[model samples]
Target: MSSSTPNKVPSSPPASPFKLALCQTPVTLDKEENIAVARDYLMRAAAAGASLAVLPECFNCPYDTACFREYAEELPAVGFKPTEDHSSPSLKMLRQTAQETKMFIVGGSVPEIANDGNIYNSSLSVSPDGTVVAKHRKAHLFDIDVPGGIRFKESDVLSPGGSATAFFAPEIDCTVGVGICYDVRFPELAMLQARELGAKVLVFPGAFNMTTGPAHWELLLRGRALDNQVFVAACSPSRSEGGDGYTAWGHSMVVDPWGTVLASADEKPALVVTTIDLGRLDTVRKSIPTSQQRREDIYRLQSVP
Candidate 1:
């Protein structure tokens, strides 16, 4: 007999109709406290019967350039185990919690120190069995100057990631695409993930400021969902008096393929839970078949990788 274990068996994903949990918690400066709070929120989500859980970006450190270096830690190479030499309390917690809860976790984003010695804003997708399934570095850095409103440049310290992250989560029975904050602004990433990578749902662990949050947050989420004909979810840290005057918009939401807002939350630390129906996604696609109507003669989206 073959030596593959039960967990390694290649069986079809369990029948769908799963629940998703969005943890819109607060980000604190203390690394240990931040990790503890995240762990608690994840456990709470698991208790609520959610198979998939998402966290907000910068959930461990302040959203500031000066703090990235201090908070940055080496990460496990893609699917490998964490290195004992480096400090990775956040990653360890994610793995432990996923194993304990038997839930797939999209670990928002964290500051990472790569071998190149450059710090990157990165997100990890962990399987229910605590395996590091995928890693997504923020491809497009947030570099903007809104005149009198806000002037924050991520290019000042953080380096941009060069690849797209789309992976299948057998536990959740769906393919998920990950993007951090400003990566949502560029439609190419979303389209590529959903259209090319066969991602049924796209999750953006973003933190939009007051200026952009109220204006374009919902609009962008809805637009991406409608155009891609896929479920979309955005998780953000709650509004708080953060240091350096950085205020998050704090409205975490989940949208259906039909561009309908299924669930959303106000500017507070809350666990937003919603049930995502894969059956309805199929119904929506059948009702409006846009994928087959694309004109390859006129235009086409190619995947370099």
Candidate 2:
């Protein structure tokens, strides 16, 4: 909601506009082909003049719990770049694509093998120079049972992350918060990113199943955008071929500060490109001023020790 923005100290205001691309490509069992497909789409997005490009959750692997560990990849050490000798194939591709395209990339969510021998659903924001600017392991592991509708437990194989994640994206001149699918359900994380970290744009790479997608996906995104007074973009993979026990709701979209859908894609493999300006967010915040009216004396929402 207000400070130094997502990763770096401010040099100027994000009062200008920039183009964003959301790649809603289809996920397949073959990891090599998936990476290749994402690479091709990302290059096209850059050619289309997007300063930033995003991919869907689990773009490199299947979404099922049983398949997590099988496709898990060890991440690079902090402050280091991924390489053929040190990084997973997926990360290597991401780094290469970011460098090749000269565009900031939100690599969506992937299964990561941590040092503790646990797997986590993680998202990474890579700069145009191929540096990993931000990394967010999902803080909220979705464990929902909708009786006859759906029952999936991410906690079955994934460990929850411990902190909020945001970074100052020099490419877009704003602090951008990165969150995976289930993390979008919790407003606390978004509030932390927007208020505490000064994130102006929040990106969520989600894969909502048909059972929940049509009912709440867009509504949740719109709510987050409206309440936080920030731009929000969510990317979802296309509906699976055989569904592989889970079929995604393929509607990747972007919402404005006023809860308006700027650009969106239906249930098919597609690319969505739209322009975003932090100037609009500033206008909304100036008119509403909810960030200044919070009664912090009564209660405060903050990170717990």
Best by TM-score: 2
Could you give me the TM-score of model 1 versus the true structure? Answer: 0.93
lDDT of 1 by residue, 1-305 (tens): 10111123234444478899999989877888988999999999999999999999988887888889999978775665533333588889998899899998999999999999999999977777777777888989988889778889998889998777777777666888888999998888888887767678899999999999999999999999999999999999998874566899999999999999999999999999999987677788899999889999999887564
Candidate 1 wrongly placed segments (more than 4 Å): 1-14, 82-86
* Reference-based TM-score of each model: 0.93, 0.95
- What tens-digit string does per-residue lDDT give for candidate 2 at 193-265? 8888888889999999988999999999999999899999999999876654789999999999999999999
**Model 2, stretches more than 4 Å misplaced?**
1-14, 82-85
Worst 10 residues of 1 by lDDT: 1-10
lDDT scores in order: 0.85, 0.87
Count: clashes, candidate 2: 7
